[model samples]
Each structure stands twice: as C-alpha cells, then as structure tokens.
Target: MLLDAKFTIGQRFKHIRIEKGVSQAQLVDGICSIAVVSQIECDRKYPSAELWGKLADKLGVPLRELIGMQEKQMEVSFQIDMVRVYIDKADHTHALELIDELEQRADLLEHQRIELLICRAECYRTARVFEKVVELLVPFLQNQQIRQNVEDVVLCDTYNKLGNAHYWLNDFEKAYFVFNSLDPDDVHFKISNCRCWNTLGNRG
Candidate 1:
C-alpha cells in the first residue's frame, strides 16, 4: 500500500527514532542539516524521497510503511487496520461490512482509494468471491488517471488481483492478457506467467 509519503512521515520518524534510542545527531548523518531533520520531524517540511528513504532505513522501517500510514493521510488508521485483519482472517463478509464505510473516506485521498480497493480485492480473493475482486478492480485499473497515478506496486497488485480473479473464473484469455500486460522486467509477470500457462495447460 504505497502512499503519498508526506503524511505523518515526520512524526513517525521522530517516534521511531526515539523508540530506537537513536539520537538526532545520529539521524542527521549528513543527509540533511539537524534543523532540516527537526523540520521534517515536526511535519514542518517534507523530505526529498532519497532523504526520507535514508531516514526510514535509519529508523528501521520501510519507506512504504511511512506512506502506508497513508492507508495516504490515514486519518482512519485503526479503522482500516480492523478491515485488514478481517480480510486476512478470510472473513470477507465482515470485512465488506467495514469496507463499505471505508470506501467513503477513500474519496478523500488517492492512496486511500487504492488501499481500500486492494483490501477489498484481497478479501474477495480470500473468500473465493473472484467476481467481486474483478468488479472492484477493473474500473480503477482502466481509469487513465488512476492507472497513471497509482504507485508501481499498487498497480502491480491491482493487476495481480484482477488476473487471479479471471483465472479462477476460467477466463484464461483475459487472465493471460492482463498478466501479459505487466512489464516483462517485473518479477511478478514471470511468476504469474508460469501460473497462467499452467492453468491453460491443465485445461488443455
């Protein structure tokens, strides 16, 4: 769930730094001035991507999690986490119940929309409600704005879910088409191609 990264990044960094007993001077490490780090910690400024990555590494968390606090601008972190836990438990019914409300908040941020869609799609996948996953993902995948703007990992995840749904529905051609559209260089494409071909081979 890649997110905007500007949200709560500073606060999270500060907290993690303190928890890890890392000093302000240690965190500075020449990536930026200590004052700049202070500004970032206070949410007074946003760090450059490279600087933030260094900061997250020093703090011992993934840059993705920094924004994934984006679940972007996760005003509803706890609510979303509950939905995630339910989905992971394969309780789609319960997850969907919570998801309906989450969808409304998604309208507020691009990352939220992507995150909620991912969560919904995964819940459907885990529940074997493949149709719902397809239904939930297709428009987002096709929306030029959404498609172009979505994070690389999020786009990959969207296509992965859609491809899996189509495969399960025995729509192998659609599955292949979707998976084939992934970048040849992407590792996921190779993995899915194997599964896609196996599915077709078994049918043949």
Candidate 2:
C-alpha cells in the first residue's frame, strides 16, 4: 500500500482555520456564504481561484502556502515509498541516507515529518541499533506539539515500536510503562503487549 499523507486541501484549510481560532462563519464572513465554508472544509466543494486568494489573505498567509502543501505532500509520499522499498530489501543504509536527506529539508509538513521520523526509527531497529531508535522517537513522543499532530493509528504504531525498542534495550521498566500506556483494547498493540508480558514474566 502507498504511504499517503491523507491531509487534503480541505483538511488543511480546516486545520489552519481552527489553529488560527477562526470560526467557519468568521472564515467566510465577507468572502462567501457561511454554508460554503463548511462545504469547502468538508471538501464537498472547491473554492474558486478568487475565493482561494481571498481566504488566504484573510488567514494572513500567502496564497501559495495554502496550495503548495499538496504538491509537496505528493513528493514526500513518493520519497516515503522509495524508503519503504529500501527498507523491505534490508538496505537500511540507503534508507537512512534518504531519510536523513528528507529530514534536512525544511519544507516537510508535520505529518510528513512524523512519518519520516518513524521510518528512521524503524531503520535503526532493523539494523539492531535499538539505542538509536529510542534516541530518535523518545523525544518526538514527548513533544506535545509534534505528538498531537500524528494520526491515532500512526501514534499507536509508534508507541508499539518505541516500547519494543525499550524492551530490546533491556529497559523492562520503561518498556512496561510504555506498553501499559497504550489503550488496553487497542488491537494494534494487543499482540505486542502479550509478547511483552510473556517476556517480562520469563525474565522475572
């Protein structure tokens, strides 16, 4: 499956609007009907070029800033696909190199940045460099600004990876804590938690 950013123009518009504390009525106050704001944010309707420009102006952002991310997200998605291929082939060196290059670029969106960090951590884990995985993801999870932007599924998987990294590093206490922090009913971590419990029991 392709790694998609999944943040559409409508989602972007809504995200920025909410972040700026702009109500839907406020967003469309002079530009268009308030009902159109919901349509646009829901992606049920696309704004006209004139309306797009006006909305951007009202939001105090450049017009391109609103439209440019879609293009960049496509590019990041393609690059992520390539990284996945390299990783699947066990070419972690190349994967890490590409991930590092992407990391250095300043244009990455929040979701894209989080995806790359998780990819980097996965590479480190596959290379048996668990410390590097912990080093990379621990600080990321701790940062509320960054962590809040991640999708729930991605966040669940990230927590699982981080917990496993801790487990492999023989930091059982930290591993247990991380595992326990996951929702008990989360299907994503159920098997992982079982393994964790079994390992801890054996070690105990």
Indicate which candidate wins on TM-score: 2
lDDT of 1 by residue, 128-202 (tens): 989988987888788944449776776787788898899989888888778778887965444466776866675
Model 1: residues >4 Å from true position, as ranges?
Answer: 1-74, 144-147, 187-190, 199-204
Where does candidate 2 stray beyond 4 Å?
1-74, 145-147, 187-191
Q: What local lDDT score does residue 124 receive in model 1, on the 0 to 100 scale?
A: 81
| Per-prediction TM-score | 0.57, 0.59
Candidate lDDT values, in order: 0.71, 0.74
Q: Could you give candidate 2's per-residue lDDT for residues 125-177 as a string of tens digits?
A: 88889999899878888894454877667778888888889888888888877
